[model samples]
Target: MGQRTFAEWLERDMINAYIMSPDSALSPLFLVERQKLESMLLGEQIKNIITCEEVDRKERHEKLEKWIRRLEMTGFEKVPLSYNGRIEATNLLQRYSHKYKFKEEHDCLLVCWSDRPLFSVSAWKFRR
Candidate 1:
């Protein structure tokens, strides 16, 4: 995705969003993991947005739908993510922070940071 598209996602909800703030109550290992992840994402933002690149203003949802349609054209069918797997993912996130959320919709697991969806995890299989 272009930097503009990526920035729109951040601008839409990430502003002032404290989705990954480290908590003193958490274990030191978890805190370190969170810091590392934050650093990686920040580095990406610096590379993509801070470098003064052209920004594509296309709607992100439209782009995502276009990709899904392309995948369908390639004979890939959306498969429901397993319930047990979703449960496991939920449990794991809950162990870290309740700020993260998972919503099951349209056979995909939507992972949200706070109220906005960060990304989705879905299974796909080729139709024989």
Candidate 2:
């Protein structure tokens, strides 16, 4: 009849049986949704809702800046530019070329890694 706390919902539904660990970080959207549900149970209006993707993007952006700063400070021969999305990679390659300059002849490389060991390192050269 009333909204439940996350703990209450978990206990009532016995959700712990399926989770790897309850201590794992929950997405911001989950926290917001939980708060909204709790508020609704207490007869309050829902104020806002946000997706987990937005939260993850913002966090990843912050991490990218930190990495860039660290790489710059350590005087790497080439700064590493990390991107989580295709759009971000495209925009950076277009607008920030001077900062992330690569040789026109060897401008792109792709590295793939997985948990298994029998993998080959693939490289690609892109013409600007």
Candidate 3:
């Protein structure tokens, strides 16, 4: 991301997939923008994205096996984070920020658990 915009990166097919934390912010344009950046990709028009909100449920434990299978099939990435925002993400965030030259809240803004990928975060230490 040194000289590339988010949309430009997608346009050039530099990133195949990315891991995102639901705890971070997100927006619908994150995915929809892909179509805009890469006009060539729009021809196929296949839905390759899956959101956690679509699968979240209270009674899914009864179907644990199927749920696990579906989740595995979807290849969702698990990001660890704390509610207090005190988790140690130096190594993780630093690498991305340095590569992307992200500054201030924009770095934080790039990771979250929103619907459309405003940003991404991960919790590696523990879970709440």
Candidate 4:
């Protein structure tokens, strides 16, 4: 659904929410890394498709705080991430390259490559 419509629903009193999004500030780095990884691990056709998708996402992406503001404006408050969830996420990442890591900030969990944030996961609940 469109963001406007989603916000309208939240304003009308939707309950718990979770969002997973690409971190726009670091998207350029992610796109480059993704392209390199794809080129190495996948075929040429898949790599080309991923490149196109990354270009489109890069054009459309917005900063993480923009979303926080949008949700907060609609009466949604940030929810603290769970310790178990964080532990699970960390364990999951260990199955891959060690360059991947997570950082918790502003009540959100960010997945990063080295030091650059690539994606964010956050939870929210309507303020009673």
In TM-score terms, which candidate is top?
1
Alpha carbon RMSD to native, model 1 = 7.7
Q: Where does candidate 2 stray beyond 4 Å?
A: 1-61, 79-128
Q: What tens-digit string does per-residue lDDT give for candidate 1 at 58-123?
A: 223323466678779999998877779888999999888888898765666778766777677878
Count backbone clashes in candidate 4. Answer: 0
Lowest summed lDDT over 10 consecutive residues: which window, candidate 2?
112-121
Q: Which of candidates 3 and 4 is the stronger one according to lDDT?
A: 4
Against the true structure, candidate 3 reaches a TM-score of 0.19
- Candidates by TM-score, descending order: 1, 4, 3, 2
TM-score-better candidate, 2 vs 3 = 3
Candidate 3 has an lDDT of 0.37
Model 3, range 16-82, lDDT digits (tens) per residue? 3332222223476775575355444532221222212354522222233354345446664334344
Ranking by lDDT: 1, 4, 3, 2
Error of 4 at 9 (Å): 38
RMSD of 3: 14.6
Report the lDDT tens digits of candidate 2 across residue range 6-47: 756644333222222222257989866764565454321111
